[model samples]
Target: MEDPVNAMLCHHGFHPSMLAWCSMHQLNLGIMQDFSGSAILLLVRISFFGNYNAEDHLRESMKECTRRFKDFCKLHSFECSQCWLTTGMLHDNQTGWPSLKLKAYNARIFLMFVRAALQAAKSAREAQGLEEDAELSYAVMAAKALCSWFALVERAGRYLTPEQAAEQETAGLVFLRCYTFLARLAASQSIRRWHVITKFHGFRHILQSARLTLYNSRFLHTYVDEDFVGVWIRLSRRVAHALFEFRVLCRFLLRLQAMRTVDQRSVPARWS
Candidate 1:
C-alpha cells in the first residue's frame, strides 16, 4: 500500500504484508541462518555428493564440484567466479543469502543445458514408444522454486503490470511450495531440529498482500539501510564514547549538511 517496504506492510495495510524493511530482509537472513542446520538444501547438496548429512564429505564434494565448474568454464570460455560455489557452501558456515543463492542457482539449468536434456529425454521416450512425462527428482523442482524466488527479487520494481504481478505471484508460490516440500520432508525424516520461523510464513502473506496491492517489495530494498548502519558502526568505533550517541549524531549531521551545501560551484573548491 504506501511505499511498500521490504516484505511490504503499512499501518493502513491489512494482514499478509509484513512490516516493511525489517521483515523481508530478516526473512532472507533468517532463512540463511536456518539453512545451515536444515534440510533446505539437502537435494542440492546431494547433487554435489551422494551422501546426506555427511558433513565429512562436504568439503571434498565442494572442491570436486568447483574443480569441475572451473574446467567447464575453461572449456566453454564462460565466465565464472575464481572459487565458484565452494566458498560459503562448506560445512559449519554462517553464510549469507548470497551463498544460499548459489545453492538455489545450481538448479536453474541454462537454456542450452535444458534443451539438450529435453532432447535426450524426448528421444528416450520416443524410442521406448511411451508417452509419460519425464520423471525428475523432487530436488530439481524444489531447487527450481528457489531460483524462481531469486528471479522474483532481482526483478522487483515499484510497480508492476497485471502480467508482471501474475509472474510475481507465481514466483512467490513456487518459493512457498518449496518451503512446504521441505517441511513435509523434514517431518518424514524426523528432523526435529528443523523449525520454520514466523518470517518464513510472513513471505506468503507478503505475496498475498502484494497481489491485492501493487507494491514491489524488493525495489526500495533494506540492504542499503543495513550498509549505512555498517558505516555508522565503523564511524562510531572511531569516535570517543564520552558523548557517544551525541558525538556520532553531530558528526553524521554535519557531514550531511556539508554535502547538502555542495553544488556546481563547490566542485573546483572540492578538488582545489
Candidate 2:
C-alpha cells in the first residue's frame, strides 16, 4: 500500500463533502489523516534494528496522534471525536491500540465536559441576555453520548467471540460504529436543540440518504450473501433508528421555534 498519509489524502481529496461523507459514515477524517501520516513514519521506524527503540517510538507516536486527534475533536466539539473511531485512528496495530484504556481516559474527559456544559448552561439561563444555553446543552450531550459510545465499543471488544473477532477484522465492524455515531448524534442533538440550527439540517438528512444508499448500493447486494442475514438486519436497524431519531429531533425543533415566535408576539406593542 502507499504511504498512509498519501493514501488518506488520496482517498479523502480535501473536500468538505468528503468530510461530510466521513462524518456520515462515522469516520474520523482528521485523525485518520494524522495516523496515515504516522503510519508512514512507523514504517520508517520499523526499518531500524533496536527492538525496544522501534517499539517505544511506535507507541509514543500512536499515543501522540490519538491525543492530538482527541484534542482537535474537543476544540471543534465532541462530534468529531465520535467520528475518529471509524476513521484513521482505528488503523493502528490491532493488538496495541489500547482501546479499553483509551475508553477509560475519554470517559473521564466526557464527564468533565458534561459538568462544564451544565455549569455554562446554568449561567446562561441566569444571565437572561445570553441565549447560549442551547449550544452548551448540546455540547454536554455530545460528550455524554461519546462516552456512552466508547463504553459500547469497549464492551463489544471485550466480549467478542472468535467469530465476531474475525468478522471485525474482515468486512469491518460497520454496525457498531454506524449505530454508535447515529445514536450519539441523535442524543446530543436532542439535548442541545441542535436541530434549531438551520445549518445542521443536512447532518440528519445525510444519515437518511446514507441509509438508502447502503440499502440499495450494488456493492452490498452483490457482495453480502444470504447467510449474512444477521449482519444485514443489524445494519438495517441502525439505519432505521437513526432516521427515526432524526425525525423526532426535527419535530421537537419545529415546536420549540414556534413557541418562541408565539412568546415573542404575545407582548404588547406599547412600551412598559
Candidate 3:
C-alpha cells in the first residue's frame, strides 16, 4: 500500500513511520475544515442536553472520524474506508442500518471483511492463547471489536420486537455458533457443526472472500514501486498471527458467558 505514513514521513523529512497520529496528520486542510465544521454542527444540535452532551459528542466525533477516514480512502484509492464505515455502523447499531443499507453493496463487502478479520483473529487466538505473537495487534483489535459487538447486537435487537427476537433466536444462535466454530477452529480443532450457518448457502463464501481480501490487503503487494517488500510482508504476517490469537480469546469470552448462565441457575442466595 506504499505505506502512506512512510510517504508522508519522507515528505516531512522525518524518519519512516515516525509521524504523530493526529486526526489531521494525513488529511489536507480542506478535509480538516469539513470535519471540524460538521463536528461543530453536530455538537450544536445537542448542546441543550447537559449529561447526554458527552455521549452526543462521542457519537459526532466518531462520525467525523469516519468522514476523515473516507477522505483518506478517497485520496489513497483503497476504498477500504467504505468497509470500515459499514463495519463501524454494524458495531454501533445506534447509527441505524438504513443509511448503511442504502449502500448495501458496500455494507455487504464490509461485513465480509469483518467476518474474515474475525475469523483470522479467532484462529490465531485459539492457536497461541495470548502469548503475544507478532500478529498480536490484529487479534487485539479484533477482540476490541467484539467489545463493540455486544453493544451492537443489543442495539440491533432493540430495533426488533420481542416476538421477532424470539422467533429469530435460531438466527442469533447461528451467528454465535459460527463465532464459536471459528474460535474453536483457531484452536486447531476441526469444525464439527456447520448446519446453522450453512443453511444460508452463500454466507460462507461471503466470509471466505472477506478473509481473502483481508489476507491479501495485509500480506500481498499493493504496489510495484515500493522497495520495503520484506518489511511489509513481515508486518502482514504479524497482523494475521495476532488476529488468530484474538479470536481464541473471544472464544473464551463465549465460554464465560455460558458459565455465567450455569452459575445464575445454581446460585439463589441473594434474594433469600
Question: Quick one: best TM-score, which candidate?
Answer: 1
> TM-score of each candidate?
0.52, 0.21, 0.22
Candidate 1 wrongly placed segments (more than 4 Å): 1-18, 21-26, 32-47, 50-56, 65-136, 191-195, 233-272
Off by over 4 Å in 3: 1-53, 78-102, 108-178, 181-202, 205-272
Candidate 3 lDDT, 122-200, residue by residue in tens: 4655676656432223323433343343233334321333443333343333444444443454345432211122222
Q: Report the CA-based lDDT of candidate 2 relative to the real structure.
A: 0.37
Poorest stretch of ten by lDDT in candidate 2: 214-223
Among the numbered candidates, top lDDT falls to 1
lDDT assessment of candidate 1: 0.51
The root-mean-square deviation over C-alpha atoms between each candidate and the true structure, in angstroms, is: 10.8, 22.5, 25.1
Better of 1 and 2 by lDDT: 1
Query: Candidate 2, residues 71-159: lDDT per residue as tens digits?
Result: 75579566533323332333334433312122323434434333343444446556776554343343344444434433433344213
Candidate 3 similarity to native, TM-score: 0.22
